[model samples]
Target: MYDLPSEFPEEPGLPDEFHDLQPQLLSRTLRLTAYSQENWFTGTDLNVYYDPTHVLWHKRPDWFLALNVPRLYNGDDLRMSYVVWQEQQPPHVIVEFLSPKTEREDLGRFYRAQDRVIDPRADQFPPPLAPVNTPPSKVEVYEQYLGVKHYIVYSRYTRRLRYFQLVSGRFQEQTLQAENPRIWLADLDIGLGIWQGNFEGVPSAWLRWCDRAGNWFLTDTEAAQQRAERLAERLRSLGIDPDDID
Candidate 1:
């Protein structure tokens, strides 16, 4: 069993606005008819401890979703960090928003077996253990250790979305058809894709969840605005001034 850290460090540097807004969008739009909110856990920028052996080793995903996990730990307490050994459930899907500094690691291109320098003092130790120099990349941790079902990487710089599915113990990149442009997540019964439009007053590409029929879910604000417009239209059809009624 792994022990939780007494205190996890705050994420370094000033927070980027996109990082904050993007995860919020994902969380808000995630709707599963099959499972209640209590049965699902969604996290953003939260530490996830995966390796029981290496207790302190963890990964902080930009956003992630775990099915069949209590939304609140013990049904009352909020989780400080997600410990895989204790939870006994892995994240069904993990998404990473790529930055220039983290692009290589997020894509699994930073892993180098040759770069691992084993400790030379292992032979003298009673429990003979060798320490590796370089930590495993984020992709390696998710694909090899955690066995996350789906791993997604979105590059705001390139405005491109990439998908990877774990198959036969490895991650295989899934293709996005140009016609559809959405990756279907069978487990969650939803699709994920990039939506080009203004979000939160910013004109940029944002990741969004869509239905099987290719209908993008609207955010709470968007839904409210839409409702208001429909009401105004109905009032106009009835030969009444909606603005005057308001």
Candidate 2:
């Protein structure tokens, strides 16, 4: 029942240079130490279908992470789109990269701080249906319909990050430090925070994951370079220069 087409005639996401690299950094650094790699799945610019009734009503999040779901669809082929009901899992966390066209909706311009109530239970899923033609904003989809535990939005232009956690079936915004902002999700034994560094040779503040120790997780390339550096140091200690090798 979940065999939904992933793409449409008109693509939904607004992608630029930052859009391309930011999601890559998120997925690459999302290391859940407690869960095996195969037990977790992360999607980049992938369609997430929320309503089984309105199969086409979906959101294409910048990046989303679902836990305890097979890396492959049904342990078979790659998923064209994430059908929430079919997978029997809502995204544990969803992230959106704010752009000029999306910030208002992403930050829920519809509601104010006094309007929402904070709830500790974040289990509101299978939300009431909206008119197929008149769908809610992106934040509503993730906060209300999907009941995603964590909702993160970041703006590269402003170097500002916003975090919302689903509490008592409603999403409540969290306070963040002005510098070295971090969030610790006990459920995943992982934390996400802003890191100021050069990635792929571009110096900028990027959202990255960290362990309980607050050490940022490295991307595959960074890990490889780290290993090579350790090996070079070992070789030098043995009176052999790794750089001298052909």
Candidate 3:
């Protein structure tokens, strides 16, 4: 067994407010009717170790889901990181929130030549002799290494969502329904779309999960609020003051 890295380098920087709240929303609303809670695991900003040969290499996704995996490591301990070799299960869906710093890498725009040379003196030889320092982008890691099935990217600034599905061993960009801005995941029996409204007291377009019927899944707080509203409505119909009772 390969020993996991105990001290990984600190991330470049911390995420902003939107980054923190958005993933919370996704984690809270994700519900699979068919699969029990124990059958899946959701992670946010967690290291996902993919390559066994290079155990140090990892990607920290904004949010990801791994089906048929215990929520805890070995069904007991919480996972420090999701090791692909150890878990033997890759994420089924991965979501990325686009920011200025990660836009190009998230979109797989960076490429490193396979035959790049390392010696500085080789610069006199040709362009191919120059050392390539570019590492694999998030897209490359998901598509080639982890083989993630669904890759979704949402831009809060543009209010645009891009969906890609792994088909025939490659990721194909999916077309969105112009009438309704939502991408349906048949396998998961849910859809993802940009919802505009106040979430956690901040009003903006946020990424959220929707059911097959196009109903937005509610977070725990939202669900509780809805229940209270329904109770208040029922009390009013019976000519009782709900506020006064409480």
Best by lDDT: 2
Per-residue C-alpha lDDT of model 1 across residues 104-168, encoded as one tens digit per residue? 56788532453222435535524313346655778889998889999998777766678899999
Report, for every candidate in turn, its global Cα lDDT versus the true structure. 0.80, 0.81, 0.80
TM-score of 3: 0.84
Native-to-model Cα distance after best TM-score fit, residue 240 in candidate 1, in Å: 3.8
Model 2 lDDT tens row, 19-125: 88988999899888788999989998888999878877888888899999999987988778898988889999988886544555667853444423333342442
Over the stretch 1-246, how does candidate 3's per-residue lDDT look in tens digits?
235753345454247788899999999989898899998999988889888787778888888999998888888887778898888899999998776556656777432342122334434532223225545777889999988999998777667678889998899988897655898889888888888878889998888889877789999999999999999999999999998994
Please rank every candidate by lDDT, starting with the best: 2, 1, 3
Q: What is the lDDT of residue 140 in candidate 3?
A: 85
lDDT of 1 at 214: 77
- The TM-scores, one per candidate, come to 0.82, 0.86, 0.84
